[model samples]
Target: MKWEDNRESTNIEDRRNSSNYGSKGRGGNMMALLPIVKILLGTKIGRIVLVIGVVAYFFGFNPLSLLDSSVTPSSTQSKVVNKDADDKSARFVSAVLAQTEDIWSEVFKKYGATYQVPKLVLFRGSTRSGCGFASAQTGPFYCPADRKIYLDLSFFDELAQRHDAPGDFAQAYVIAHEVGHHVQNIIGTLDKVQKAKQNFRSEKKSNALQVKVELQADCYSGLWAHYSMKNFNSLEEGDIEEALNAASAIGDDTLQKKAQGYVVPDAFTHGSSAQRMKWFRKGFTQANLESCDTF
Candidate 1:
């Protein structure tokens, strides 16, 4: 993964230190009361009270309730801070993102279509997304609604220490996989699958569809890898192995077995270890977009 000298993407939004939940002040305290209100409104009596309160407020019957001084709104501000250690990871991610943009732009040109680059968001703890509130626990995800990829750099440490998939290339593969989702969104694959999922009544069928989506993204990641290596000679000796190991480590079977000491094939939203590795290899060896049709 010789990416240090490569170009960095300008589409990156770094919100690593921003607090989306709220700031620790009067506004924060008021915002923090929302969850409690939601919980209380979950009950029948509380719902009735809420309805009455709303009605009274609209009729000006409860002016004091509407003019609560403690519920003042405040603007949320974000502050950007860079840590020395994270700077290296940020550069690597930016480089990988830029490479994907270049490769995919070329690939799309061959198909008589223009590629629209997606933004990449680097955040920590929690952040607001078009899809919803996101946290590091949600892992890396691509929100088609916003056409952006969100990531937490700390996941690299978890990938290395917990998943046993150390190496810069493995990290690159993760970014590529999410970018692959953006590609699927561009090519209408995600739209078709999502439409089909709407008619699926069974959880098993839904999960199966999700598995196909995930595997295809994996193959697309490999497609990027294939061209990246061919175009820029970016791969080192163990890079491919690092990516394969990462695919295997995060497979549905491997993760489920580790979490619950059992495996449920029907619950697999992603494929098995063998399936993930095979699809990735298929795209890598074939070195073309046609080889990435997991559906």
Candidate 2:
């Protein structure tokens, strides 16, 4: 992938280690918390409450109670500051985001509409988002409420080491996929899906809708790749394969098998390996948004 001469996105906000850590987005009852939060805050729930209290005390309302990762761009750019070595990665992300802006802007114009570019947040450990706090373990996500993308770059290491999806393009694919979610939000696909979800007969059926949502995102990522290849010289000889590997590596079935030694379609929020590869390839082959209407 060639990105050296790419333009960096002005819609990025770098908040690597600034008063936002250990925050999570899965609000209400926290299920995944049983494994990480208890161990991190001590084996007692009372201690965790105390920690929240202390945070709210010193920082005044946890300094993150209203953690909205969306840093709406002012006329002035934010000052560059961080406590980690994420500057380079942040710059790469900004470049990819800028490329998406260019591609989508042109695509929108073709349909007699304007494109609104979303912001990207680069954080370490944890950060607050529109919905709530988020950790890197959430992987990369797009918060429709804030119209921003949240990513922890460390996920790239896990992508390579654990998922066997190693490549620069795979990393870019991760971000682009989340950006696809942003696209869904902009075009009202997300709201339509969420509304339909309320009528799902069971959790399994609802999860099925989630699979569609994710598969469409894969298609959208392919749409981004189409532009990235044509406009920027970002597509190398093996880049497409790298992204397909990522699509397969992170399939819900693969992840469930690895985590629980069994595959459960009923609980699958994302799609299966075959389905993921199919949708991603579909988008790549067509490179047309009209063909990506999974909703």
Candidate 3:
């Protein structure tokens, strides 16, 4: 990927130097509460208490009163880093975001709609998100509630060293896929799918729907790649293969099999390696939004 000299996005929010444990900083209160909540939820007694709390809520009891009010949450000041022009990773991310902005803007113009750019948040360890408290373990995600993309640059290292998918374009593909989710949010596709999920009684069905959503994002990433290639001649010799390798590496099936030594198709939130690669290729070759309908 030839992105070094490209334009960097102004919509980036750098929160990498903030403490993950919720010292006095943005979203500190929520961040402080999440770990306690998680620990409580991990126990059987805590689960019972949670159920009782829900039951109390139905009976007109205020569950908020159960929280300790004496513990004052203090805010920590965040030290934003890499503001200088030489931060390679941050620069690469901003450049990729700019490309997505340009590509999607043109695509939306053709459809007689204006594109609203989404903010890209760069954080470290953990951070507060509109969706909920986010940790590095949650990976990269797009929160529709905030219309922003959250990422930890450490994940790129994991993508290279742990997942064995290295290369600048592989990293770019990850950003593009998350941006694709922002596009879905803009087009009301995410809203419709979320509404449909409300009626789904089976976890399998819900997972299938999620798979479609993720695959569509993958396809949209390819659409961006197609346009980027034509518009800026951004792709190098092995860029497409790098992206394809990344898609394959992060497939739900691949991850599941690695984690458990078996595959559970019904539990897959994202598609299989073959499906991901296929959809991405479809969008790359077709180079049209209509071809990205995974559902």
Give the best candidate by lDDT: 3
lDDT of every predicted structure (CA atoms): 0.85, 0.80, 0.86
Structural similarity to truth (TM-score) of each candidate: 0.81, 0.79, 0.80
TM-score of 1: 0.81
Lowest-sum lDDT 10-residue window in model 3: 70-79
lDDT of 2 by residue, 1-295 (tens): 8886888989998776454433433342145445545565765775777587567757544322333333221212223344244567777888899999999898889888889999998876667889786777687899999999988877877899999999889998888899899888988899999999988878888998999999999998988998899888789999999999999999999999999999988898889988888888888889888898776
Between which residue pairs do clashes occur in model 1? none
Per-residue C-alpha lDDT of model 1 across residues 111-172, encoded as one tens digit per residue: 99999999999976667678876666788999999999999887888899989999999999
Using lDDT as the measure, name the better of candidate 2 and candidate 3: 3
By summed lDDT, which 10 consecutive residues of candidate 1 come out lowest? 71-80
Indicate the residue-level lDDT of 197 in model 1.
93
Using TM-score, give the best candidate's number: 1
lDDT of 3 by residue, 1-295 (tens): 8987789999999877654543234255446567767877999998888789779957856453446442222222223344462257888999999999999999999999999999999986768889987767789999999999999887888899999999999999999999999999999999999999999999999999999999999999999999989998999999999999999999999999899999999999989999999988988999888999998
How far residue 285's Cα lies from its native spot in candidate 2, in Å, is 1.3
